[model samples]
Target: MDVFEAIKSRRTTNGYFLDKPLSDEHIKILLQSASYAPSHFNSQPWRFVLIRDKARREHLGKIAGRSMREVMAKGNFWKRYLKYFRFSKEETDKSGDGIHIDNMPAVLKPFIKYLFSEKGGEMMNKLRVPYLLAIDSKKLVSRSPLILGVLLTKDEYKKDDLSGMYSLLALGMAIENIWLAATALGIGVQFISLPMEAGGAYWQECIDMVQPPENYELIALFRFGYIDPNAKRPTIDWSSTQRKPVSEFCYEETFGNKWIPKE
Candidate 1:
């Protein structure tokens, strides 16, 4: 696929991937693509560690699952993240972001609306039933073929410095490059995001498994593999993810002065 086409079609795969390993050549291409992202002062402060070992991936999955479950057990899930969930189709259609209930599995869709409700959230928290979802997510992680860890190194420039901000932007560019490259190759990728929110100890354990360079911090984790046609995935109205017209966020030299695009 062409670059623009890949960019337009790229979407995060929801927890379902075929049990196939990516070829060495394809992997190299993705890494090379990531490396080409523009960096400030050419200080590419990002390092990638690819884990292909099944056992290690499984172990990491367990850590992610367990950590996620623990968070749910703390009864703060609704206050923490679920509040951001837009459950109704109407709500999803109106907003440009946040997860939609339609993208959820049929079995869980009914529960989602209630789970996000005030009384429902309180009751579920008391019951602590969401932990089961975490268990299944852990299995999904274990089955993934490739687990990639992205580490951010200590910048020569401090966090308060412009150089540090540039480095972060560059890292985002690098990740987008890899995602588009994988899309072009018909590979799917989904983030292993729980560890980051779980806590420092959980996050540290995840980084330790990858054995990254000293002082480098884990910034992101993801699993990539072929799509499993039979796997049930969250139902998403992809059109909702489309960007709003330029007039919405663009300006003509000053804020609030909208810049209209040529027809």
Candidate 2:
């Protein structure tokens, strides 16, 4: 399918058929598409670890399930139990630092709490699907104390923060390519961020099994397989979910100046 058609049709598939296995050839094509995604200075920083082993997938599911439950339980009681939880001095000290978190207002604490406490668990459990794909970044791309230091220039350090953003956007593009391919092939796929329970150590163990290039770091994971044809998809308002008019999002050299021109 063409790019626009793929973009319009792609949807997240959570429920998958465990019995159906994707062919090696199909998997190859999907990876090939991902590998070609554009990156900063043509630095192909992303690596994918495809997990086809049923036993390992099951283990991941169990860990994710438990992690989800814990997060949900904490969310349900966090407000009432706020007094019992201690806020670290380090966290408070870093609040005013010129980093991304510096702009966060103290009033948003409850909202942040709700974000971490509530949806965090649901997002974790969403990882328990059929095939798990672990995405990693090359170590060379992120070896310094500052995560995006490798890509930042001395002159552009404070002004531009596009290095890491570009890498992630490229990775996201790769993911979209794979997801669309899966859709066309009648396969189901879900993108999931790693749960706190399956943190660095656990992920490192899984990555070691794949034996990727020495410079890679785990980035994201995906669960995929085939879905039952008879299953009903959740109803969504297409207009709300679909992209806004290009005129609304796009502009000329200056902000709000129409580039497309009034037709």
Candidate 3:
């Protein structure tokens, strides 16, 4: 696929990938592609730990499941992440970003709407959505042939510092490079967001298990493998999976000054 096509068509895999494992050559190519991304002052502070061991992957999946349960048990899951779910076209239009409800599984759609109501929280807990989701998540993680763990070297950016900001920007570029390359190769990628959702204290356990090289901290985890062409389409519609119009976000010269491209 063309580079632009890959970039424009790339989508996050929210469902399970096929049982295929990425070849060693494929992994090497992805890492090489990522290494080519530009970095601040050429610092290139990113480090990657690739997890392919089934036992270790299962361990990570367990950690992910535990972390997910801990978050849902707080009883404020909807309140904390409400803005990130768009259930209708109007809602998606207004936000211009966030996960569209259509992308969610069919079984979860009605429950998602219920989540906004005062009683929905109770319903969610009653239905054990969190537990069910965790089970599904474990199946995904355990079955994925590869999990790429991204790390950043210590003593660089503090996230609030200027250099740190640049380093992060570079890291994003690196991630995109890998993602696009993988997309071109017919692979799918999904984030392991449970660690962040569960917070540092819990994430430390994941770090210990993954055992990244010394002097590095885990930044992100992404599962990658081939997609199943025969998989059923997700129940929710996916119109918003496409990028928002440039006019919605791009500005002419200042904030709130919309930019209109000429034909």
Top TM-score hit: 3
Q: State candidate 2's TM-score.
A: 0.57
Q: Please report how far candidate 2 places residue 192 from its true position, in Å.
A: 2.0
lDDT (Cα, tens digit) per residue for candidate 2, span 22-75: 678778877787777776777655667666665656555554444434534444
Candidate 1: tens digits of C-alpha lDDT, residues 18-123? 7788899999999999999998877888899998899998898888788877776565655566645776657765665566645545555557667666557555
What is the clash tally of candidate 1? 2
Give the top-scoring candidate (lDDT).
3
Model 3 per-residue lDDT tens digits across residues 52-153: 999988888887777777777565665677767677877877777876666556667767777655467777777676776677677777788999999887
Model 3 segments more than 4 A misplaced: 103-111, 117-119, 232-240
Candidate 2 RMSD to the real structure: 13.5
- Model 1 worst lDDT window (10 residues): 234-243
How many backbone clashes can be found in candidate 2? Answer: 1
For each candidate in the order shown, give its overall lDDT on alpha carbons. 0.77, 0.47, 0.79
Instruction: Give lDDT for model 3.
Output: 0.79
Best-to-worst lDDT order: 3, 1, 2
In model 1, which runs have C-alpha deviations exceeding 4 angstroms?
75-78, 103-111, 126-129, 234-242
